[model samples]
Target: MPDSVLVAYGTTNGSTARIAEAVAEVLRRDGLAVEARPARSVTSVTPYDAVVVGGGLYTGRWHKDARRFVRRHRRALAERPLWLFSSGPLDASASERDIPPVAGVRKAMDRLDARDHVTFGGCLEEGAKGWVARMILRSGKGGDFRDFAAVEAWASRVGAELVGEWERSR
Candidate 1:
């Protein structure tokens, strides 16, 4: 029901950014104004009526930018309609089952009273940074496991809830 929404993401190698964009696209389709931006680049959350925050998980921790963003804007974020998401898990488990938020993200969700949280399959491919990524690629364990259909499906649900809330408020 918010006229404006912010989809902010923290991504390493850009996979999480794409996921954030997909969420923004769905929200826009549902007749809301949405902007998707990197979490580090977002200076404030005050301009938006609602917010969706996402981070790429690394060693069970949310990206630093995401963690900082939440900490920096905790008060504003807590006052708004907020949702959280994580992008990680190189396997299909995220799509197959409910992947709970990592401890840090879970704490943030609780502190902010976020409406919901979801985890999506992560993408790891050629040209990824870090030795671990290289090792994974060399070991032939890397692939694009991101399911856009599933992403869209989840976004549709979020959009519906927001739209429904807006209609009722009117």
Candidate 2:
């Protein structure tokens, strides 16, 4: 049987969730069974052969839910093939060039031995939950900056690599 993969994300205004869903779709196309879920809602990571965790960047920090999910499932995550991602740069920078993960994410990657990390653009729209989000929208800096093409390309690479590894093992 093919391996089941989990794509979990933490999002404040829902953009990160969309990115995660896009990633999952690519992985599915690559022949892996994939599930995309909110990081906070996932009860366990034991069922998945590999994991992709993503969060929205917030004030130089990763989203709280993603951080907590990693902390809570550290042991399980460490044993799995893991990847991390952060989305938050309300501009074209992410599409233009690579953006490094934040400090906490770097530490988590090191400790968990994650295979890769990526930073995609973010979105700030009206009705976003926090005062900060509202302020950004008020300033006219809010728009959907996520590049689905880039996101799918990255995910295809990941899915290809994972599938190759699984095939070789069998």
Candidate 3:
């Protein structure tokens, strides 16, 4: 395994970016070199040992830039360990439903043999949304429902895996 990790994310309201930062922090604490950047900022995946892709859901789809990034770098990503995550489902309750993975992401997953895919709770600010999204948020049905503990724990696990891989490569 390589000593570098990249946490690339796409966010609209910025929640997914926070999640990506948290993951990167945990990995950094594990003594690995990690860089977190927006998906659009990543020109290539060639320099990373492993990649973690994250994006927020908008109208049941991931941000377009994220989808495009993955597609463009799918071949390079396939040669490395890859993990995918999404910020969706307003709360833990929403996780119970069988929401299909975003179509573009599903295609990427097939190509990358992604080691893991996760869906975490998302958020929508009161006035930060468009009319339709605002209406949904105003309905009292949506909330900032991220479970930071769960997010941290998952990151720790991934860090452990990266550490193991790094040691073996040595």
Candidate 4:
């Protein structure tokens, strides 16, 4: 049977979802069954061999839904391979440390024993954000800052790791 992965994400302006889809596509191409969706839409993680959770970053935090998802499924997630990512940097060139995953979720990541946590670049659309969000984005960053090539490289690495690990276990 093919290995299956669940890629769940939370996005306020949709950039994180796009990143999640890219990750899922790379996993699918690597011959894994992949289910990509918003965090709210996922009710369970037990059906898959592995799980990936990602979210948009805001005010140095991940969207609430993504955090809640991890909290709710903490036990189930702990039993399987779990990976995390956060997309919030408006500068595609920013290093992951400069746009780290919400520090608050470290407990959840630890409980789930996540294999990896990545910080990817994000995108901001014109006028799609509220005043606060706009103001935040305007603090010297805007436009589509997502680096598809970089995202793809990370996803490819993830895919290879998952495949190799599964094979070794089998």
Per lDDT, the best of the predicted structures is 2
lDDT of 4 by residue, 91-128 (tens): 75554445445676666787778988888887887775
Question: What shift in Å separates residue 92 of candidate 1 from its native position after superposition?
Answer: 0.9
**Residue pairs in steric clash, candidate 3?**
none
Q: Which candidate is the best by TM-score?
A: 2
Q: Write the per-residue lDDT of candidate 2 for residues 55-149, one digit (tens) a residue.
A: 99988999999999999999999999999999999999999999999999999999999999999999888789998888888999999999999
Query: Clash pairs of candidate 1?
Result: 1-162
lDDT score of model 4? 0.83
- Candidate 2 or 4, higher TM-score? 2
Best-to-worst lDDT order: 2, 1, 3, 4
Query: Could you tell me which 10 consecutive residues in candidate 2 have the lowest summed lDDT?
Result: 1-10
- RMSD per model, one decimal: 1.0, 0.9, 2.0, 2.0
Please list the residue runs of candidate 1 whose C-alpha ends up more than 4 Å from where it truly belongs after superposition: none
State each candidate's clash count.
Answer: 1, 0, 0, 0
Better model by lDDT: candidate 1 vs candidate 3: 1
lDDT of 3: 0.84
For model 4 the TM-score comes to: 0.90
Which stretches of candidate 3 lie above 4 Å from their native place? Answer: 94-100
> What's model 1's overall lDDT?
0.92
Q: Which tens-of-lDDT digit does each residue in 25-47 have in candidate 1? A: 99999899999999999999999
lDDT of 3 by residue, 41-140 (tens): 9998888999999988887888777798888898899999998888878767435543456777787888889888777888777765467677877788
